[model samples]
Target: MSKTTPKYLLLSLPTSVVPSHHADDALEAISTTVSAENGSAAPFSIPEFKIGTLDALVQQADELAKLESQCQGVVAKVADALRNILDGDEAQIERMMVVNDKPVDQYLRTFQWNKVKYRADKSLAELIDLLHKEGASIDNDIRFKYSQYNQVKNTLATLQRKQTGNLSTKSLASIVDPRTVVQDSEYIETHLIAVPNSQEKEFLKNYETVAPMVVPRSASLVASDNEFTLYAVTTFKKHSVEFVHKARENKWIPRDFKYVEGGKEEERKEVERVGGDERKVWGETLRLGRTAWSEAVMVWIHVLVLRVFVETVLRYGLPLDFVSALVRTPSSKQADKAKKNLDDKYSYLAGNAFGRDKKGRVQRDDPQDMHGAGEGSAEYTPYVFYEFEFN
Candidate 1:
């Protein structure tokens, strides 16, 4: 407490522990210095000693190291927790079934059984036969029988329909005739169909007896040899027709569609005329192939809100207290607006709080229900109700 006493020693020791004599000595010296500098009558008070530079630096370094260790531990725990959350059996199953591809409903509907049939070299007839052999009676049900009959009828009908001239058994036979076998001239030729009217003509045209062939016009068949070319071409054409029919059924093109000549050129010109800003706006709608701007805006807003909420939770844990405060605040209008935004954005979070499952049925994880204020409900539900309550 002497005038020469070091600041560190004074600061390191407590005020209460400092001797009264020393404090009096320090205060008197400080008062004299202040009086001389200010030339004032008022006595000066000595300020409390502050920690020295070396001590402060050492303390800060120690705290920083401790903080670093704590942060590392927290990071490790979070990583393990996230991995466990993502790698759980249910999560893995959901990831495989839902995330890796389209939803189960979409997969089941869009799955091309026809493509599978073609790849496997299996006919619809063979499939039906196998089913029948397995005791699956497709005959008992009239609808089933009708469906099968209609399919066969349709195939034959399509073939007959495509015929250009007068239909005849001979002509039909010619179209559907299988590939000719390469053999010696001595081998006897087998006739699958011998129409009465064409027997003499058939005998006269024996050397010109061609097997039934379907010629397709697809690019895939362009390089095929003549022996297999017809089959490939026919298959491609049939498939193309089927695809176009399906597209039409799905309303992919307008019913009043007129074939556009140089449509891409027109589109490019329109884009250029519209300039960059309008072009971007037009591009978003075109890219999504839809015209619901409000819905798109809502979706983007929801994504942004969810992203912020997730980042907040990941950084500082769930903001339940802040959310509750916001919900219960006196500014009902602001609260209502906030709740509306949340309902539009985070309704899925609410749905996850209350949802059910049934056997053999695709369960909805989120169910839409009444939300927001002044809707005959005194209590309001938080988005993370289940997480906050249970966790």
Candidate 2:
């Protein structure tokens, strides 16, 4: 490859995951990469590849995601063993569920220890070796880069959602445009503040008196819920810090509702640049016969494929809606057509996958299992495809 050439992968793995009765059945496919096969020829050779960087990142992301899925069985087994050891076998299974970072750390520790354990039986040792090798794929570095990629991707999605008027209900109802908030008066800043539901009346009656007293009628209530009452609070920009502290004293919770300035984007960008080896593969179907791929289809496929990819790979670990929201299909009847096209495409991998039916509710045998990862000794429900509709 020339010095100017960028990395790419020639992926041909099945769109949906297939269960391997024996863990080693899929290892060879996982270890293969298109870049490894023919060095000089670019993967599929995009015609004037316009979205090379973004597409490359998505491919890398998918590759990592696929590795995670293949490794799930081994990881799931390790997590269950550790959770059982920590919670004791006698505890109610529900109470022993491990759902967050704390318990995951415990599972990781035990898993690493198992990797180092001494075993005499050849079969047992070989199984342990497989787990250890797979475990290496999910080490801190992969997890770190993968998480950063998700954070950045999610941040971009949030911005796009806002642009498309698809922001969260809370954000839409309570967040005033910063530009509108600064109306007429240039010195005042309007903040979207949330005060405790219990303190709603207190804020109405005493916020002005408690916060060194001000005019413009204290604060205007924008929206409310059982737990919080959103408010548009205005004060001189110079005194905003003191005003914030004063509001806090009266039970207002600080939330930086400004998604653009919320720092997640900046943090995500800083972390995303730290690339990993998994991102070398550019497209799953970009190999030999698929060389006719175009830039536009590739972009749409990236979103659609990653939505299905992450959904299946991290089924138990991600939100049920997953990345389905980011899948850009047509606006009307064609949307339904596109959804069907995707659904039919993966129909072969349907048996092991979890999905949402025509209704929005996720189709699952156990509802609580949706809590993910630490919920039980459950296996990942593969091929987790969801309809391309939003609530």
Model 2 residue runs over 4 Å out of place are: 1-180, 183-185, 216-218, 254-391
Q: How far is 141's C-alpha from truth in model 2 (Å)?
A: 8.8
Tens-place lDDT digits, model 2, residues 107-182 = 2222211213322232322433443454554343334443444455555555444433322223442255454355
Q: What lDDT tens digits, residue by residue, belong to model 1 across residues 29-80?
A: 3233223222211111211112224444344333333332333333233223
**Which one is best on lDDT?**
2
Error of 2 at 244 (Å): 0.4
lDDT score, candidate 1: 0.28
The TM-score obtained by model 1 is 0.14
Number of the predicted model whose TM-score against the real structure is largest: 2
lDDT for position 390 in model 2: 13
Residue 209 CA displacement from its true place in model 2, Å? 2.2
Tell me how candidate 2 scores on lDDT. Answer: 0.39
